[model samples]
Target: MLLVPRQLLRAGMTGDVPYYGGRFSPAQAYAAAHPQPRPAPPPPAPTSRADQQLAALQNLFAAGVLTAEEYQQFAARVTP
Candidate 1:
């Protein structure tokens, strides 16, 4: 949102990282001309029930969808 970037967008000079504001960056346009399919990642090793619960809570907290107090409350439920 800086002045430079804002001006670039205004001038239609989108940078790297796919299309934005209905305009594709130079790299994105090139990529579109040549398509490639990436291999999917290997499945993760199975996790314990406790580990799964902890991960879920961590994701929610990291996304700021849960306050610290709410996080602690949910974490207690997962741990015990």
Candidate 2:
């Protein structure tokens, strides 16, 4: 038959007393008991027809297909 001291068992269960020369701090014990929550993933990127139209207008202006006045009119129509 073998017997262990209640105090030693209590200390081990509660991680209050150091064992084998290594101690468990309150923070470490709490962390071991409760883990931190993971951060939420970032939101997806936005997509809009206005963005596509703006890109198209820029391309058209660069290609000399649309004049300044035409670009302005197209921008006004496409913008929210």
Q: Point to the candidate with the largest lDDT.
A: 2
| Residue lDDT tens for model 1, 1-80 | 37665656755654433446778878889999999988999999765898988898999999999999999998898786
Encode model 2's per-residue lDDT on 1-80: one tens digit a residue: 44988897898797784554466677788898999899999998876777998999999999999999999999999886
* Reference-based TM-score, model 1: 0.40
* Poorest stretch of ten by lDDT in candidate 2: 17-26
For model 1, the local distance difference test gives: 0.82
Give the CA lDDT, 0 to 100, for residue 23 in model 1: 86
Model 1 misplaced stretches (Cα beyond 4 Å): 1-47
Error of 1 at 27 (Å): 80
What's the TM-score of each model vs. the native? 0.40, 0.42
Best TM-score among the predictions, by candidate number = 2
**CA-lDDT, candidates in order:** 0.82, 0.87
Cα RMSD of all models vs. native, in order, equals 22.1, 8.1
Off by over 4 Å in 2: 1-47
Clashing pairs in 1: none
| Candidate 2 residue pairs in backbone clash | none
| Global lDDT of model 2 | 0.87
